[model samples]
Target: MTALSPLDKLMPRGYVRQMLCFPSTSAEVSHTLKTGLARVLADVPYLLAGIITSEDRKHVSLSECYQTLEDLYSEQDISDAIDYVVIKQHHFPPSSFAGPGIIPTDTQPPFPNPTPVFRTKLSLVKGGLILCVAVHHCTTDITGFGALLKLWASHCRTGASAAAGFDPAWLNRKALLERPDTSNRPTPASIPELLHVKGPDELTKIAALASQPSDPTTGVFFFPQKTLQALKHAVNKHIASWGNGGWVSSSDILTALLWSAVLSAESDPMSDRKGSNTIGFPVNFRSRFNPPLPPDYLGTAFIMTTATASRDDLISLSFHAGSSNDDEPLDSASISKLADIASIIRASLHSIDEERVRNVLLYLDGASGDHPPITLGPRHDGVSIVSWADQNIYGLDWGDIVGTCDAVRLPKLMYKRYPIVLPRVPANPAGDEGLEVIVSFDRQVFDKFRQSWPMRRFSTLRYYS
Candidate 1:
């Protein structure tokens, strides 16, 4: 019966779906997970509660009524969910395989009937198993969802008696909505990131655009440890020359690289003239508070920030200029350009502090009447990036039965323009440690991007739909 925060209400209308793949599959393994999930739900009953929205649809609250375990968990055969050829083609299934067949629920929000806030499905393949968990976005962000998964895994490894000491305070969601002294809070319109908030009509249009079939050129890029080190070294080397004492992390540089490539691919030199393109990313504010929020607090505590740069500056690589071949090495000028882009991203991230976070909370708290959904970035020309690299998704262990997760996947129904940077794959016997990034774009744009200098020099095309 707890009310969700304003920011929670503003989250995109859908379930946050995550797929974990394992090499082993057995009826016993499925039974253990089902029992584990039930135990976790009994300990945290709110997860089994339904979402109840206000008549005006401006507010949402968790329902007091809870559903039974049978209503929330399911088990099915892999052949009923996906083709076996897909499993053979990939050691781990790609994002395309995520669907209602495996999830067994409508992913879109405003459920036609009351449904549990969380649902789990286990699909058994010939030689493996895929566990798909769908948590309503309004209930929690990905970080919170990860915490829940970890808890469930812990319960599976250790008996329920050993897991009984779990703290109840970690489930508190209302802590994020506490209103502090707001006399000095900044106005929503005054925030640079809020400037592009779209009207309801614009949001409707965006929804329409999303419903259209995605372009066939969606795929993933795998960047190995060696490639990532080379990229970080090159970018940091350029920054060190300036002597600003400022630097960017591998995540920052990777984001910048992807942003530049996406913009370059989408830009039409024939008609796209001088203009600025923006990149928007969500910043986790869990630790930015003065006393710092609890690490285990399961709630939505993130806000979006953006960085902008002119098209010419970002697309100055030799390939964009048509002066380089696919096999040509990245020159000093390209590295310098990437360094600048990464710096912009780093600065934007640094701008989100405790004060700004409080200001955003104040704005969301005060919002009333009919207004547009907040825009993460420009509706048409910008890119929105979400990074799961820090989530440690691959580290979740389901005891000796499930082993470690082989790979993680998301549904194609997610916004195509919004690329997700997945956690680095676990080190393989070959000793390769790397990241998998999923991206989608029009045929022409993707074709150009895959052949771009960065793609050729630093990554391998792993999967495409």
Candidate 2:
């Protein structure tokens, strides 16, 4: 049995599901996937292992298990998983594929007995196929998950004997549990990125948030390359005047933009809502290690960092309160406000260096039972933004039979305030490379979000039931 890292134990008990859409259907696709997965398991046997929880259910480990391809792979009619119109339009309508029909239901957490770490399903549409892979979050993070998909695609494209060289060392989970010397450990309070909700009241609030019903109006918004460039340029130009010679990334600007927009849409100006609105985002620490973890090292190597702004400050930055004209240039005050928000995000991420990472690891190492020194969930009124923008999900090739993926979709999240930033799609014929963002909200908030000036100014919004 391989013990999971402390951070892994903190992952929510659930499966991370991803859907890859292909423009062509094939009779042998399922067979190819099964064979490829078998080959992958042969090389990375831990993936086939079953997850075992500790007596108290506070920790988890992987146990070797014998499971066949039949146990993991299945085929169902396309209509059962998604609408036929999705194949024609090449874009999934919001909440259209949100159900569990596409993924393995048994993969959901709270396993009384050990269960397989991975599961897959394939559905063939009229002119296309949808491949769904669900991996337990405790088994790997998104980077590791992407690596598994890429390797699976490789095995499918080339014969198993073709030597799709992959390092088995990357699968070592214990590497993440390693820590610095005792003298170098920092106190838990030193890490501002973490929020300790150990009090009964705070824990109750978090439980309330978790058990809240999910909002139905999840919308997908696409922003083209030009618009992203414009937003970055505007922020960079404003910050350059400070003469500090530092600059913020496009991601920082986009995060600020979305954070402000979402908070604005949910803001009830009439209500006496005070306090800061925080945005928590995960920062990949794979490279922050002294020697730096391998690019393909397969384990969770990130921690959440938060950036906060006063509710009033965020409201002032909201596009809803900006100029009525969509095309009008941002006023000087607005530009400055945006630049400030982006700077806060950039600084918060930059704060997580090797020392801080080690400090967090040491802190979590002491956690037990249901209480950890830190909480990964977003604050009650805050938003959590997870970016898959750098993940190479769209580039996974399944040989000439299926070619490249046409698009990717994530299932509706249980947390309505959480938003995911998907990878940028390849440039279209018009030379526009666009990014897709999925956000969930109730009908009223969704309506306000759809009409928000940022949505009107920078993206095309699509809604579905």
Candidate 3:
């Protein structure tokens, strides 16, 4: 038998399974979930664990695969793992990102925006077709969900849970939330809006960026480990240089990098174009909500840090919040401005009364009654999405259970740069770990931005230019 991941010894050997049921069309998702899904969560990890991992471990990685003696599972375990992956595999109609949940809708949703966590779709292909289901993991963690997927995949190939000895209830989020002080919600300066609990459209501005095909404006960049190192090094230097009087947050750093790219495009002869770009980070309302967002609440824990700038605007954001004296050189001055803006926005987010966000939800929940009230009416234009994921809780042990975390990471890009996620492929059996970015844009915006930072260009450009 293959060695189990370090955390697998504590698994309870069962699964919480959700069928990723896809239909002839998208119209079937709401109809099916409304009629069938009955609980906040139906545990099924045992059944799903086996399905996702192969006996020889060639196709996937079981970061948590070996079976524990205490966690024996069988086909009977299928009923347990249903909550995180949603109720039905959602089908988007042929065009436009809208789906069947809305009125006058005859078609499925247009998977326009990636929603990043859009329904956490689960799929199993067989007999020339596939079955899918969706769930918001606000109910569990990625490790739990990944474990669940393995169970489902295992089940499909072997039909018998006896072979895998898997268990779905293996110390999941439910068990963790029960721990003391897990409610230490992050007091970050920014967070993202949960794409979940909100309606979906085919081409959300964020999705459009994430899915873009080229780097027409970024002037061909490389993202290998070396590049990542250089980025980290550059960041270290940038941070150290800005002693104080700047408002630089992680989100601010991300925004500055991407906006710089957008700014570069504004002056580009071929790709010049003006448009609004935004940045949003996820903020957990765990402390703000009633019952405190289920101790195990897993998916999309965030509020957004949204800031926008048009093509001609020279993103003069400052990092230092203190000195407005502007004694620094012009190039350094620009960076400081960003720092200041970031600090201001950070204050805005911290100031948001937790009670207010909670009240809005409570009011909506009461009006909507038992029905899930998150819906999409119309898609907004020019509002691209940017977010980051944090996974600090997966390291803890839950009495009889334990977990290992692979922290979440997101790709950053300008509006025109659609990033391609490394989906499962032949060379990548364990699958791609993160998203791949490919930048592109109108030549005009590109030209303006290229000239906007002649100072930065001369300094850093000496290396890459």
Top candidate when judged by lDDT against the true structure: 2
Off by over 4 Å in 3: 1-247, 263-281, 287-296, 299-301, 308-330, 367-381, 391-465
* The 10-residue segment with the lowest total lDDT in model 2: 189-198
Distance (Å) between predicted and true CA of 411, model 2? 3.4
lDDT for residue 458 in candidate 3, whole number 0-100: 19
Q: If ranked by TM-score, best first, what sequence of candidates would result?
A: 2, 1, 3
Candidate 3 structure quality by residue, lDDT tens digits, 349-398: 57444544433333322332233323221122333333212322222221
RMSD (CA, angstroms), candidate 2: 3.0
Tens-digit per-residue lDDT, 249-271, candidate 2: 88888888788778778888575
TM-score of the candidate numbered 1?
A: 0.89
Worst 10 residues of 3 by lDDT: 89-98
lDDT of 1: 0.72
- Model 1 pairs whose backbones collide: none
Q: Candidate 2 at residue 268, lDDT?
A: 81
State TM-scores per candidate: 0.89, 0.90, 0.38
Global local distance difference test of model 3: 0.32
Candidate 1's displacement at residue 60, Å, is 2.6
lDDT of each: 0.72, 0.73, 0.32
